[model samples]
Target: MKDVIFDDFQNTVSESLIRHKSILDIITKLQESNARINRAIVKSVTNCGCIEVNAKKQNTLENTNMDIESLKTCLSTQVKGTLCDNCRDVIQNEIGNNLFYLTSLCNALDLNLYDILLKEYDKINTLGKYSFR
Candidate 1:
Protein backbone atom coordinates (compact mmCIF):
# COMPACT_ATOMS: atom_id res chain seq x y z
CA MET A 1 0.00 0.00 0.00
CA LYS A 2 2.82 2.39 0.91
CA ASP A 3 4.64 1.62 -2.34
CA VAL A 4 1.48 2.16 -4.31
CA ILE A 5 0.89 5.53 -2.63
CA PHE A 6 4.50 6.53 -3.24
CA ASP A 7 4.24 5.61 -6.91
CA ASP A 8 1.03 7.58 -7.27
CA PHE A 9 2.61 10.66 -5.69
CA GLN A 10 5.64 10.36 -7.95
CA ASN A 11 3.43 10.13 -11.04
CA THR A 12 1.44 13.17 -9.96
CA VAL A 13 4.61 15.20 -9.34
CA SER A 14 6.05 14.10 -12.65
CA GLU A 15 2.94 15.14 -14.52
CA SER A 16 2.92 18.52 -12.81
CA LEU A 17 6.58 19.08 -13.64
CA ILE A 18 5.94 18.17 -17.27
CA ARG A 19 3.10 20.66 -17.52
CA HIS A 20 5.25 23.36 -15.93
CA LYS A 21 8.03 22.68 -18.39
CA SER A 22 5.64 22.76 -21.32
CA ILE A 23 4.32 26.14 -20.22
CA LEU A 24 7.83 27.49 -19.84
CA ASP A 25 8.77 26.24 -23.31
CA ILE A 26 5.72 27.84 -24.85
CA ILE A 27 6.47 31.14 -23.10
CA THR A 28 10.03 31.12 -24.39
CA LYS A 29 8.89 30.45 -27.94
CA LEU A 30 6.33 33.24 -27.70
CA GLN A 31 8.98 35.69 -26.55
CA GLU A 32 11.26 34.72 -29.39
CA SER A 33 8.46 35.05 -31.93
CA ASN A 34 7.51 38.45 -30.56
CA ALA A 35 11.07 39.67 -30.76
CA ARG A 36 11.46 38.50 -34.33
CA ILE A 37 8.20 40.20 -35.38
CA ASN A 38 9.25 43.43 -33.71
CA ARG A 39 12.61 43.39 -35.43
CA ALA A 40 10.99 42.72 -38.80
CA ILE A 41 8.53 45.56 -38.26
CA VAL A 42 11.32 47.97 -37.43
CA LYS A 43 13.37 46.87 -40.39
CA SER A 44 10.40 47.17 -42.73
CA VAL A 45 9.55 50.65 -41.49
CA THR A 46 13.13 51.81 -41.79
CA ASN A 47 13.64 50.41 -45.27
CA CYS A 48 10.47 51.96 -46.62
CA GLY A 49 11.36 55.34 -48.14
CA CYS A 50 8.53 55.23 -50.64
CA ILE A 51 6.35 57.73 -48.77
CA GLU A 52 8.99 60.44 -48.26
CA VAL A 53 8.32 63.89 -49.74
CA ASN A 54 11.83 63.98 -51.16
CA ALA A 55 11.24 60.77 -53.11
CA LYS A 56 7.90 62.05 -54.35
CA LYS A 57 9.42 65.36 -55.39
CA GLN A 58 12.25 63.64 -57.22
CA ASN A 59 9.87 61.56 -59.28
CA THR A 60 7.24 64.23 -59.96
CA LEU A 61 8.81 65.73 -63.09
CA GLU A 62 6.71 65.15 -66.23
CA ASN A 63 9.72 64.30 -68.47
CA THR A 64 10.11 60.53 -68.56
CA ASN A 65 13.24 60.76 -70.73
CA MET A 66 14.90 63.15 -68.32
CA ASP A 67 13.88 60.90 -65.41
CA ILE A 68 15.39 57.86 -67.16
CA GLU A 69 18.64 59.72 -67.82
CA SER A 70 18.77 60.90 -64.24
CA LEU A 71 18.15 57.36 -63.01
CA LYS A 72 21.00 56.11 -65.22
CA THR A 73 23.34 58.71 -63.80
CA CYS A 74 22.22 57.94 -60.26
CA LEU A 75 22.78 54.24 -60.86
CA SER A 76 26.26 54.95 -62.21
CA THR A 77 27.02 56.88 -59.02
CA GLN A 78 25.80 53.89 -56.93
CA VAL A 79 23.05 56.03 -55.40
CA LYS A 80 19.64 54.47 -54.92
CA GLY A 81 16.73 56.19 -56.67
CA THR A 82 13.05 56.27 -55.86
CA LEU A 83 11.15 53.15 -56.75
CA CYS A 84 8.86 53.37 -59.74
CA ASP A 85 5.17 53.51 -58.93
CA ASN A 86 4.54 49.90 -59.85
CA CYS A 87 7.46 48.63 -57.77
CA ARG A 88 6.40 50.80 -54.88
CA ASP A 89 2.88 49.43 -55.05
CA VAL A 90 4.13 45.87 -55.11
CA ILE A 91 6.36 46.41 -52.09
CA GLN A 92 3.57 48.10 -50.15
CA ASN A 93 1.25 45.21 -50.88
CA GLU A 94 3.85 42.68 -49.77
CA ILE A 95 4.46 44.54 -46.53
CA GLY A 96 0.77 44.66 -45.76
CA ASN A 97 0.39 40.96 -46.38
CA ASN A 98 3.37 40.09 -44.20
CA LEU A 99 2.10 42.27 -41.37
CA PHE A 100 -1.31 40.63 -41.51
CA TYR A 101 0.17 37.13 -41.43
CA LEU A 102 2.44 37.98 -38.52
CA THR A 103 -0.45 39.49 -36.58
CA SER A 104 -2.53 36.37 -37.10
CA LEU A 105 0.31 34.10 -36.05
CA CYS A 106 0.88 36.07 -32.87
CA ASN A 107 -2.81 35.99 -32.02
CA ALA A 108 -2.99 32.23 -32.47
CA LEU A 109 0.04 31.66 -30.28
CA ASP A 110 -1.38 33.94 -27.59
CA LEU A 111 -4.67 32.04 -27.54
CA ASN A 112 -2.89 28.71 -27.33
CA LEU A 113 -0.78 29.91 -24.44
CA TYR A 114 -3.83 31.21 -22.62
CA ASP A 115 -5.64 27.92 -23.06
CA ILE A 116 -2.63 25.99 -21.72
CA LEU A 117 -2.39 28.19 -18.69
CA LEU A 118 -6.09 27.83 -17.95
CA LYS A 119 -5.84 24.06 -18.16
CA GLU A 120 -2.85 24.03 -15.87
CA TYR A 121 -4.65 26.24 -13.39
CA ASP A 122 -7.69 23.98 -13.32
CA LYS A 123 -5.53 20.91 -12.87
CA ILE A 124 -3.73 22.52 -9.94
CA ASN A 125 -7.00 23.59 -8.36
CA THR A 126 -8.41 20.10 -8.63
CA LEU A 127 -5.20 18.64 -7.23
CA GLY A 128 -5.35 21.01 -4.29
CA LYS A 129 -8.69 19.56 -3.23
CA TYR A 130 -7.40 16.01 -3.13
CA SER A 131 -5.60 14.25 -0.24
CA PHE A 132 -2.41 12.57 -1.47
CA ARG A 133 -2.95 9.64 0.79
Candidate 2:
Protein backbone atom coordinates (compact mmCIF):
# COMPACT_ATOMS: atom_id res chain seq x y z
CA MET A 1 0.00 0.00 0.00
CA LYS A 2 2.75 2.42 0.89
CA ASP A 3 4.62 1.58 -2.27
CA VAL A 4 1.49 2.11 -4.31
CA ILE A 5 0.91 5.55 -2.82
CA PHE A 6 4.54 6.57 -3.29
CA ASP A 7 4.44 5.50 -6.88
CA ASP A 8 1.27 7.46 -7.47
CA PHE A 9 2.70 10.54 -5.79
CA GLN A 10 5.86 10.34 -7.87
CA ASN A 11 3.83 10.04 -11.03
CA THR A 12 1.66 12.99 -10.09
CA VAL A 13 4.68 15.16 -9.39
CA SER A 14 6.36 14.07 -12.59
CA GLU A 15 3.33 14.94 -14.67
CA SER A 16 2.97 18.31 -13.00
CA LEU A 17 6.64 19.10 -13.63
CA ILE A 18 6.34 18.22 -17.26
CA ARG A 19 3.06 20.06 -17.81
CA HIS A 20 3.67 23.23 -15.84
CA LYS A 21 6.88 25.23 -16.13
CA SER A 22 5.51 27.63 -13.52
CA ILE A 23 6.25 25.28 -10.67
CA LEU A 24 10.02 25.55 -11.02
CA ASP A 25 9.81 29.21 -11.96
CA ILE A 26 7.76 30.03 -8.92
CA ILE A 27 10.18 28.21 -6.65
CA THR A 28 13.11 30.17 -7.99
CA LYS A 29 11.33 33.50 -7.76
CA LEU A 30 10.11 32.81 -4.28
CA GLN A 31 13.67 32.18 -3.15
CA GLU A 32 14.91 35.38 -4.75
CA SER A 33 12.01 37.46 -3.46
CA ASN A 34 12.40 36.16 0.04
CA ALA A 35 16.04 37.11 0.16
CA ARG A 36 15.39 40.58 -1.24
CA ILE A 37 12.52 41.23 1.18
CA ASN A 38 14.56 40.08 4.13
CA ARG A 39 17.33 42.46 3.24
CA ALA A 40 14.88 45.35 2.82
CA ILE A 41 13.25 44.61 6.14
CA VAL A 42 16.59 44.52 7.88
CA LYS A 43 17.60 47.81 6.37
CA SER A 44 14.27 49.41 7.31
CA VAL A 45 14.57 48.29 10.90
CA THR A 46 18.18 49.29 11.17
CA ASN A 47 17.52 52.79 9.91
CA CYS A 48 15.75 53.55 13.20
CA GLY A 49 12.59 55.04 11.77
CA CYS A 50 9.72 56.08 14.03
CA ILE A 51 7.73 53.11 15.29
CA GLU A 52 4.40 54.54 14.19
CA VAL A 53 5.65 55.11 10.66
CA ASN A 54 7.36 51.74 10.33
CA ALA A 55 4.78 49.57 12.07
CA LYS A 56 2.48 48.95 9.13
CA LYS A 57 5.32 48.37 6.73
CA GLN A 58 6.96 46.01 9.17
CA ASN A 59 3.76 44.07 9.62
CA THR A 60 3.31 43.64 5.89
CA LEU A 61 6.92 42.61 5.48
CA GLU A 62 6.56 40.05 8.25
CA ASN A 63 3.48 38.60 6.62
CA THR A 64 5.25 38.42 3.31
CA ASN A 65 8.14 36.66 5.01
CA MET A 66 5.79 34.07 6.42
CA ASP A 67 4.25 33.51 3.01
CA ILE A 68 7.70 33.09 1.50
CA GLU A 69 8.66 30.63 4.20
CA SER A 70 5.58 28.56 3.43
CA LEU A 71 6.40 28.69 -0.27
CA LYS A 72 9.92 27.44 0.47
CA THR A 73 8.52 24.48 2.36
CA CYS A 74 6.23 23.71 -0.54
CA LEU A 75 9.16 23.82 -2.92
CA SER A 76 11.22 21.56 -0.70
CA THR A 77 8.49 18.97 -0.84
CA GLN A 78 8.67 19.00 -4.58
CA VAL A 79 12.35 18.05 -4.56
CA LYS A 80 13.16 14.64 -5.91
CA GLY A 81 14.55 12.81 -2.94
CA THR A 82 14.14 9.43 -1.36
CA LEU A 83 11.39 9.33 1.22
CA CYS A 84 9.39 6.90 3.30
CA ASP A 85 5.62 6.63 3.40
CA ASN A 86 5.15 8.92 6.39
CA CYS A 87 7.48 11.53 4.95
CA ARG A 88 5.68 11.40 1.64
CA ASP A 89 2.31 12.10 3.24
CA VAL A 90 3.74 14.91 5.31
CA ILE A 91 5.30 16.49 2.25
CA GLN A 92 2.01 16.27 0.37
CA ASN A 93 0.13 17.95 3.19
CA GLU A 94 2.75 20.65 3.54
CA ILE A 95 2.62 21.35 -0.18
CA GLY A 96 -1.17 21.68 -0.14
CA ASN A 97 -1.26 23.99 2.87
CA ASN A 98 1.59 26.15 1.63
CA LEU A 99 0.04 26.50 -1.82
CA PHE A 100 -3.23 27.65 -0.23
CA TYR A 101 -1.39 30.17 1.89
CA LEU A 102 0.57 31.47 -1.09
CA THR A 103 -2.62 31.90 -3.12
CA SER A 104 -4.19 33.89 -0.31
CA LEU A 105 -1.09 36.04 -0.04
CA CYS A 106 -1.25 36.78 -3.77
CA ASN A 107 -4.88 37.88 -3.48
CA ALA A 108 -4.13 40.01 -0.43
CA LEU A 109 -1.19 41.69 -2.12
CA ASP A 110 -3.11 42.24 -5.39
CA LEU A 111 -0.31 40.42 -7.17
CA ASN A 112 -0.60 38.54 -10.41
CA LEU A 113 1.34 35.46 -9.29
CA TYR A 114 1.36 33.95 -12.77
CA ASP A 115 2.86 37.07 -14.20
CA ILE A 116 5.78 36.83 -11.81
CA LEU A 117 6.10 33.16 -12.63
CA LEU A 118 6.03 33.75 -16.37
CA LYS A 119 8.67 36.43 -16.07
CA GLU A 120 10.89 34.07 -14.12
CA TYR A 121 10.30 31.37 -16.70
CA ASP A 122 11.40 33.68 -19.46
CA LYS A 123 14.58 34.53 -17.62
CA ILE A 124 15.42 30.88 -17.12
CA ASN A 125 14.51 30.09 -20.70
CA THR A 126 16.83 32.79 -21.95
CA LEU A 127 19.71 31.75 -19.76
CA GLY A 128 19.42 28.09 -20.75
CA LYS A 129 20.74 27.22 -17.36
CA TYR A 130 18.78 26.00 -14.36
CA SER A 131 21.26 27.18 -11.72
CA PHE A 132 20.10 30.68 -10.89
CA ARG A 133 21.62 30.62 -7.47
Candidate 3:
Protein backbone atom coordinates (compact mmCIF):
# COMPACT_ATOMS: atom_id res chain seq x y z
CA MET A 1 0.00 0.00 0.00
CA LYS A 2 2.72 2.48 0.99
CA ASP A 3 4.79 1.28 -1.91
CA VAL A 4 2.18 2.71 -4.25
CA ILE A 5 2.88 6.20 -2.89
CA PHE A 6 6.62 5.83 -3.36
CA ASP A 7 6.16 4.49 -6.88
CA ASP A 8 3.86 7.36 -7.76
CA PHE A 9 6.29 9.93 -6.36
CA GLN A 10 9.21 8.34 -8.21
CA ASN A 11 7.26 8.29 -11.45
CA THR A 12 6.20 11.87 -10.98
CA VAL A 13 9.76 12.94 -10.37
CA SER A 14 10.96 11.06 -13.43
CA GLU A 15 8.38 12.78 -15.59
CA SER A 16 8.72 16.23 -14.05
CA LEU A 17 12.50 16.40 -14.00
CA ILE A 18 13.21 18.58 -17.03
CA ARG A 19 16.23 20.74 -16.21
CA HIS A 20 18.52 18.49 -14.20
CA LYS A 21 18.60 15.49 -16.51
CA SER A 22 22.27 14.77 -16.06
CA ILE A 23 23.30 12.52 -13.18
CA LEU A 24 25.84 15.09 -12.04
CA ASP A 25 23.18 17.81 -11.95
CA ILE A 26 20.80 15.58 -10.08
CA ILE A 27 23.46 14.66 -7.52
CA THR A 28 24.42 18.29 -6.92
CA LYS A 29 20.81 19.39 -6.60
CA LEU A 30 20.28 16.57 -4.14
CA GLN A 31 23.22 17.86 -2.12
CA GLU A 32 21.81 21.39 -2.18
CA SER A 33 18.46 20.12 -0.96
CA ASN A 34 20.29 18.34 1.87
CA ALA A 35 21.98 21.60 2.81
CA ARG A 36 18.63 23.37 2.85
CA ILE A 37 17.30 20.78 5.27
CA ASN A 38 20.26 21.27 7.59
CA ARG A 39 19.88 25.02 7.40
CA ALA A 40 16.19 24.82 8.23
CA ILE A 41 16.89 22.70 11.29
CA VAL A 42 19.60 25.04 12.48
CA LYS A 43 17.37 28.06 11.96
CA SER A 44 14.70 26.44 14.10
CA VAL A 45 17.23 26.33 16.93
CA THR A 46 19.03 29.61 16.39
CA ASN A 47 16.66 32.06 14.70
CA CYS A 48 13.25 30.95 15.90
CA GLY A 49 14.39 29.67 19.27
CA CYS A 50 11.62 27.09 19.14
CA ILE A 51 14.14 24.37 19.89
CA GLU A 52 17.43 24.23 21.81
CA VAL A 53 20.33 21.87 21.35
CA ASN A 54 21.42 20.48 24.70
CA ALA A 55 24.37 18.61 23.33
CA LYS A 56 26.75 16.71 25.61
CA LYS A 57 28.50 13.37 25.67
CA GLN A 58 26.24 10.54 26.73
CA ASN A 59 27.09 9.15 30.14
CA THR A 60 26.66 5.58 28.93
CA LEU A 61 28.84 4.13 31.67
CA GLU A 62 27.10 5.76 34.64
CA ASN A 63 26.20 2.24 35.64
CA THR A 64 28.73 -0.57 35.21
CA ASN A 65 25.98 -3.09 34.39
CA MET A 66 24.41 -1.00 31.61
CA ASP A 67 23.73 -2.99 28.45
CA ILE A 68 23.15 -1.80 24.88
CA GLU A 69 19.42 -1.56 25.45
CA SER A 70 19.99 0.44 28.61
CA LEU A 71 22.24 2.82 26.71
CA LYS A 72 19.36 3.57 24.35
CA THR A 73 17.35 5.02 27.22
CA CYS A 74 20.23 7.25 28.30
CA LEU A 75 21.02 8.48 24.82
CA SER A 76 19.47 11.71 23.68
CA THR A 77 18.93 13.44 20.37
CA GLN A 78 20.16 16.47 22.39
CA VAL A 79 17.14 18.39 21.16
CA LYS A 80 15.23 20.02 24.01
CA GLY A 81 12.07 21.32 22.36
CA THR A 82 9.42 20.63 19.74
CA LEU A 83 9.30 22.32 16.35
CA CYS A 84 6.84 25.17 16.03
CA ASP A 85 4.42 25.27 13.10
CA ASN A 86 6.56 27.52 10.89
CA CYS A 87 9.78 25.59 11.44
CA ARG A 88 8.02 22.28 10.93
CA ASP A 89 6.55 23.44 7.66
CA VAL A 90 9.90 24.79 6.42
CA ILE A 91 11.74 21.61 7.41
CA GLN A 92 9.11 19.39 5.80
CA ASN A 93 9.30 21.34 2.54
CA GLU A 94 13.10 21.08 2.51
CA ILE A 95 12.88 17.35 3.14
CA GLY A 96 10.37 16.97 0.33
CA ASN A 97 12.74 18.72 -2.07
CA ASN A 98 15.54 16.43 -0.96
CA LEU A 99 13.41 13.35 -1.63
CA PHE A 100 12.40 14.65 -5.04
CA TYR A 101 16.03 15.06 -6.09
CA LEU A 102 16.93 11.72 -4.57
CA THR A 103 14.15 10.08 -6.58
CA SER A 104 15.32 11.95 -9.66
CA LEU A 105 18.82 10.57 -9.21
CA CYS A 106 17.43 7.05 -8.84
CA ASN A 107 15.39 7.44 -12.01
CA ALA A 108 18.41 8.69 -13.94
CA LEU A 109 20.26 5.58 -12.80
CA ASP A 110 17.32 3.35 -13.81
CA LEU A 111 16.72 2.28 -10.23
CA ASN A 112 13.46 1.71 -8.41
CA LEU A 113 13.05 3.90 -5.34
CA TYR A 114 10.67 1.52 -3.64
CA ASP A 115 12.95 -1.42 -4.25
CA ILE A 116 15.91 0.39 -2.78
CA LEU A 117 13.82 1.28 0.26
CA LEU A 118 12.77 -2.34 0.69
CA LYS A 119 16.34 -3.57 0.44
CA GLU A 120 17.51 -1.03 3.03
CA TYR A 121 14.57 -1.95 5.26
CA ASP A 122 15.45 -5.62 5.05
CA LYS A 123 19.08 -4.94 5.89
CA ILE A 124 18.18 -2.85 8.93
CA ASN A 125 15.68 -5.42 10.13
CA THR A 126 18.16 -8.24 9.67
CA LEU A 127 20.99 -6.42 11.40
CA GLY A 128 18.94 -4.80 14.20
CA LYS A 129 21.21 -2.84 16.54
CA TYR A 130 24.38 -3.86 14.65
CA SER A 131 23.15 -2.50 11.30
CA PHE A 132 25.24 0.66 11.47
CA ARG A 133 28.24 -0.12 13.64
lDDT of candidate 3 over 45-127, digit per residue (tens) = 99999999999888876798977787777888899999999999999999999999999999999999999999999999999
Model 3 residue 65 CA deviation in Å: 4.6
Candidate 1 overall Cα lDDT vs. reference? 0.47
| Candidate with more favorable, higher lDDT: 1 or 3 | 3
Clash number for each model: 0, 0, 0
Q: Write the per-residue lDDT of candidate 2 for residues 43-89, one digit (tens) a residue.
A: 33344321112232223334454554464443322223344555445
Give lDDT: candidate 2, residue 31. 61
Models 1 onward score TM values of: 0.26, 0.37, 0.92
Model 1 is weakest, by summed lDDT over 10 consecutive residues, at 51-60
lDDT of each: 0.47, 0.46, 0.93
Clashes of 3: 0
Q: Name the weakest run of 10 consecutive residues (lDDT summed) in model 3.
A: 124-133
In candidate 1, which residue ranges exceed 4 Å CA deviation?
A: 1-79, 111-133
Report the backbone clash tally of model 2.
0
RMSD values, in order shown: 22.5, 17.7, 1.6
